[model samples]
Target: MHTFSRADFERFGQLYDIEFRFPAIHGDNSTDDYIVARGEITEHSLASGFRFTFSSLEVLEAYDSVSCGHAPLLVLVVLDGIVRLTLGSVEHELTPGTAVSMQLHPDYPLQAHQPEQQHLEIMALAFDPRRAKLGHVSPSLHGLTILPRMPLRQWKVPHALQQLLRTYAGLTMTGTQKNLVLEGVALQLAGLGLGSEEQESPDVPVVPVQQRQRLELVRQHLEFTPDHDHSLKDLAQMAAMSPSGLRAKFRAMYGVPVFDYLRKCRLQLAKHYLEQGFSVEQCANKVGYTHATNFSTAFRREFGFSPRQRTVDQKK
Candidate 1:
């Protein structure tokens, strides 16, 4: 296993952004944004032409948008925490137990939101679609189209598959045995994540390009400044739509109600604060909650544990 800390990951990001361009250019080309403030990412690459990464890290800061490099195809499984991403014009949220199989285009790179303070554990498998010969392994990916706005598939990860990944991560093996095991895992992940040949893309409502761009502004506001007490009228004005139109279209496009998304962003940041040794009341106020009780209730509902409990657990 190859382990990379934040500094190492940042250096590689810089290199990939600035110098590397053999097979393809990867990593977001940014100067100021630090990817992670804590934790590490471990990777295992197989000779069978697949690379798998297990990343456990905390976001250094909140970003409304960050570009991800070109990959022909990628299967991402959210082991824990939430990841928000935009492909083409559609925004998606990946929670624990969820996985996505996406066919990415070079021109329209994937845009991501890294939530501040939130700890994330993500497992990603990436490969070149042209050379992967996935048809022989899984017939479903045979005719997968490579589009700028491709039809990606989202599904729940099986419990057994999750256990298998954890098991593989713990195993001590090398050489041919490791390669064989990795090949099998790769196939299984791809088969389950993107296995349905008949899986149809969800019907995303077609809004005008101008309206979509404005809607994105609203989303960015909610994501980046979740602590603000945003009003629907103001947000509607920002999106150049009626309040109801904004409400309906935002949900239609982003898969969640507008304010509901904001609540999630706030709670995610609050959780991060609690992990960093902040008091429950402090976290509640910081995330715009007037009452600590309300914040505690919401936090427990969202994360299945109280803020104080999170702090205690971390100490242990």
Candidate 2:
């Protein structure tokens, strides 16, 4: 188990530009009482033109507390353990993988119940409704909107929200970059709450067996000679399918256009050579790029840094 001390919480809060406060408890308090593990208050601007906090609460016992009383809407995600939340008269049990959105009213109260030694990690995003202009968002997001006096629950986790959290917690992004990433996440969460579940299309035709076989053959061929300058028409002819048909089917199966995949393959080969200490010109030629300059441009776009810089960064 990972235990965070009070000093750890304080340092993290300072680094993230949030406030962390531990509530003072009276002597002889029971284990099952409302306690604040780390109180985070944030007002940082997001790239999407909003400001909010990424706060966590560690509940050691059963406790009731009112949160987001001043905010318009609050979003909660349970990262670990179980929590039973009572909003008004209704009760909701939130477990791992559960995302809930609740709108706050002045009189709304929340009660949290947990067993002894059981810990719950809760992340909250508090935002103002009037300033957020929730109603003005696209109609597709209407379902995600947590209206005042209403509580909403959804089953599946939003992909964008997950990505945002991953980036915020894992990546080394700073300043404008971090804000942009957070805004994107907020927008995605809003969209998921507002939009209807997208229906999968059943009418789209499946690729024929022969075409599928041909795509597999192409994949194998590329694996063998990834550095080759194979044109789309040539690949289509080899696959015995029209160029357009091959393009669409390849995208459907691989999630990237054929040419783009080829480019990635070439770049991967070049990166391997670079990591093995090959010079720019040698690596470029080995990866089918005629000029080192061209290889460098493509490499920077793909990896966000030059090959040499990557090697240097790795050394550090």
Candidate 3:
């Protein structure tokens, strides 16, 4: 995390024309200006070869009358005070320890209203979804996506994300390192958004007992023989189900499909082996890849870093 003193903040305020007021909306007498105190922008790279940005803003009694828009996904963490956010017909009242996310586009209008005698402190991160690799696997998240505003009590922030945010606040990182950190933050956020929903609601569907047994059997078989070149048909036969049924059931049970989960498990094993100082070829073979290049490509695609690059990053 980069720290900006008052002087540094003043310079930024002057540069960006901060504290400017806009016209009143709906005939309200309240002021429409925003006072930005401090902020920082940073980026991070992921093992999956993606880069993202993490940014934060500290403000006091900020208000936006004129609707402004953003292109990336915007996640706002309200640390203090109350902020009234209106998106389309929805109105979200955000308070301390609240998080609200929205897909920012040109058409959406966002207005902020802060009552007098109170200060609003918010930290926000914006990132492009295209570069985040969210679209490739989850087509439903391909476009602008907005997560409902949730209190911290309802949705617990993962420890990894919390640590990344802390690192963003203090680390004296270079541009490349910043990108890496941002990417890490994005990955963590995505995991939180996609992973937690299933665990939160038990009503969604579960695999039948027989199917669950088959899936567990397949996982155990993979663990026992990681190098086996088993096809979907073979796994489906082992599960006593058709390939399509297997895919659907696995996706319902887990967030990802069976093959994707298998690949991810293999890549995680490869990463562990690599971290233990195993050679690239050894890690590749241990993870069921016949060719080292194939493993390298898959590792990069999944984690945003090649095995060699990850090793170097781990050392650093």
- Among the numbered candidates, top TM-score falls to 1
Candidate 1 weakest lDDT stretch, 10 residues: 17-26
Which scores higher on TM-score, 2 or 3?
A: 2
- lDDT (Cα, tens digit) per residue for candidate 1, span 17-81: 31211111125634333233467667777644467888777755454434355554678888878
C-alpha RMSD of each candidate structure in angstroms: 10.8, 18.9, 20.4
What are the per-residue Cα lDDT tens digits for candidate 2 across 1-316? 3344445544654653333333443355423233435333334554222455444444443334444244445566666567666553335677776777655444444455543234455556655534545344444334323342124444456555554553454567778777666666676665444335334246546666567657856754564477888988889988888999889887665556888877877887777777667877898898799988999999999988897786676567
Candidate 2 residue 32 C-alpha distance from true site, Å: 16
Task: Evaluate all candidate structures by whole-model CA lDDT and list the values in order.
Answer: 0.69, 0.59, 0.57
Candidate 3 lDDT, 1-316, residue by residue in tens = 3443434544544642333342332243332232333455554444343344444544433435323444335566555566676553224567666566554444445555655323445555554554444334245444333322221111345555555565555778766776566655665565454334545246546666667757756654554355568799998998899998878776666567777767876886788778777888998987789899999999999999899997787778
Candidate 3 stretches greater than 4 Å from native: 1-62, 65-72, 115-120, 129-160, 163-167, 194-316
Model 2: which residue pairs collide? 141-194, 142-194, 143-193, 143-194, 144-193, 144-194
TM-score of each: 0.50, 0.43, 0.39
Model 3, 20: alpha-carbon shift in Å?
6.6
Candidate 1, backbone clash total = 0
lDDT of 2 at 170: 50
